[model samples]
Target: MHNIVLFGPPGAGKGTQSQKLIAQYNLVHLSTGDLLRAQITEGTALGLKAKKLMDEGLLVPDEVVIGMIGSALSANQQAAGFIFDGFPRTTAQAESLDRLLAEHHTKVACMIALEVGEEELVKRLLERGKTSGRPDDQDETKIRRRVTVYNTETAQVAGYYAAQHKFHALNGIGNIDDIFAQICLLIDQHKPAVDEAPAAATREVKA
Candidate 1:
């Protein structure tokens, strides 16, 4: 499977890029925000609990987030792969995900970290707010807080995966298509080699 994580801070265009990746690669997109939103729309218990935290601008707890992700994975095991847009924001969440995927015999093939300057991110976020009217982008304070929280919480997970040799940093400043091309290139370069021992053995059999 080609499971991967699209990692980045808020306003890093992760959502936009993930959509492109899903369309181009035919991978399942597992976005934590979408998962929670679905639960909230369906009035699931976990959705109600997460809604409380989100209403207060507080992050949903790790256990709650993990549960949402687990449910998504179980449902998508037959998919070609998954592109995790906004999950595993903490070390604990990362560890839980590792264990969960291990149980399913799937590992993350890569983590593409969309790198952008804070000033640029803030600018884009403010512009998005003007156009999108998202509550989180309504005020500078909330936008800044979201970025701060992302850095404090999610940045470490980048390092954690980097140490595992699965992290690839992609420049996120450019046209949407341009940025996506960078990500595709990185994935191409980092993709693990296919098992060739069997091919070699087949050649020996032919000989």
Candidate 2:
């Protein structure tokens, strides 16, 4: 499996890029935010617990999120691979994800990071806020805080992947298709080569 970790700050268009990658790779999409929000919208006990923390821009507990991911991996065993979005946002979570993938007999092939400046992120998120109706995006203070938190808490996760030689960073300021093309190039480079077919036995020939 050619699993990938779609890494980037908020408003870096990770979600948008993930859709493109999924189409290209036939990979399953796994977003921790989406998973938690699904439970929240369903009013499950876990949802109630995550809602408050999520609204305040805090990450949900590693164990809780990991449990959900485990379930997802099991359900999607037939997937070619998975693109992890909004997950492994912390070093602890990254370690847990490694263990989980090992159990599934697959590993992250690469972490493709979309690099965008803080101001650009703020600008993009504010524009998104106008239509998204997410309170966290509506507040500039919260947005900046989220960025800061990402830098402080999530950026370290890059080191974990980098140590394993599986991190790739790209400029996120460009045409959407161009960015996707660049990302695909990187993915292509990292993709594992398939085994070649065995050669047929040669028959004796007249000399």
Candidate 3:
């Protein structure tokens, strides 16, 4: 399996690149933010809990987030692999994810970290807020707080993956296609090769 974690702060183009990577690799795209929104829209019990926290401008608990991811994994049993976006934001979450994947006899192939400057991130997010209709993005203070929180809290997740030799940092400022090509090169290096159908068939016949 060629599981990947697409890591970055807000406005780092993780979402855009995730779409392209999914199409190119036939991988299941798992965005935790999207998953949580789905639960909220569906009015699940977990969603109710998450909603209360979100309304208070607090993060949903790690266990709740992990539960959602577990459910997603169960649903996509036959996927080629998964491209995980907006997840494993903490070292604990990273550890949990590793354990969960190990249960399926697969491990993360790599974590592609998008490195973007704080000022550029702020500019992109503020511009996006104009059209995104997201209150959090609209406020300069909130945007900087989110970035600061990422740096102080979530950035350590990179070290967790790095210790396993599964972290790759790429510059996030460039032509989209050029950046994607660089990411693909890294993925291709780590993704396991699929067995050739003809070769497998021949072996079965000989057997």
Candidate 4:
């Protein structure tokens, strides 16, 4: 089972890219925000707890996030793979993901980090505020806080994965298709070689 992570700052188009990647690669797209919102909307037990924390402006606990992801993964075992959009932000969550995927006999194949300038991120987020209707997104102060938290808390995981040779950074300023193409190239490079093609080519050349 192939597993991938798309890491980027807010407004870097991670969600946009993830949707394209899922369609092109047949991978399941797992967005933590979507999952949590669904849980809350459904009034699940975890959702109730998460809603309380969110209502109070507190981050949801890691265990709750992990449980949600674990449930998603198990239910989608028949998927081609999974593309995690915003789940494993902290190192603890990252490690937990590693363990959970291992238990399922799968592993993270790549972590695609979309690099964008902070100024641009702030600009995009502010514009997003006008349309998102999310209280956190609508508040500039809260948006900045999320960015700061991501830099301090989540950015470190990029280096952690890089040390393990699983990190790939892509410039995120171009057109949506351009960024998606870059990611597609990386995934192609990581895919195992097809033996059938090599064998056929060898025979044709011999003839």
The digit string of per-residue lDDT tens for model 4 on 20-123 reads 87777677777888888888888888899999999999999988888788878776666667788776877788899998888776778888888888778888
Per-candidate Cα RMSD to the true structure, in Å, reads 8.6, 10.6, 7.2, 8.8
**Per-candidate local distance difference test:** 0.76, 0.80, 0.81, 0.77
Q: Candidate 2's residue-wise lDDT over 1-207, tens digit each?
A: 778888888999887888787777777788887777776787866777778888899977888788778877776666677788777887888999999999988888899889899999999999999999999988999999998887776568888888998888899999999999999999888887851122222211110
Candidate 3 lDDT over 3-74, as tens digits, reads: 899887899998889878877877777778888988888888888889999999998998888777777777
Model 1 off-target regions past 4 Å?
43-59, 192-207
Please give the TM-score that candidate 1 achieves against the real structure.
0.81
User: How well does candidate 3 match the true structure in TM-score terms?
Assistant: 0.84
Clashing pairs in 4: none
Regarding TM-score, does 1 or 3 come out ahead? 3
* Clash count per candidate: 0, 0, 0, 0
lDDT (Cα, tens digit) per residue for candidate 1, span 1-207: 567888887788888888777776667777777788888887788889999889999978888877777777676656666778777877778888898888777778888888888888888888888989798776778877887887786678888898898878888888999998888887777654652111111100000
Ranked by lDDT from best down, the candidates are 3, 2, 4, 1
Highest-lDDT candidate: 3
Clash list (residue pairs), candidate 1: none
The TM-score measured for candidate 2 stands at 0.82
Residue-level lDDT for 205 in candidate 2: 10
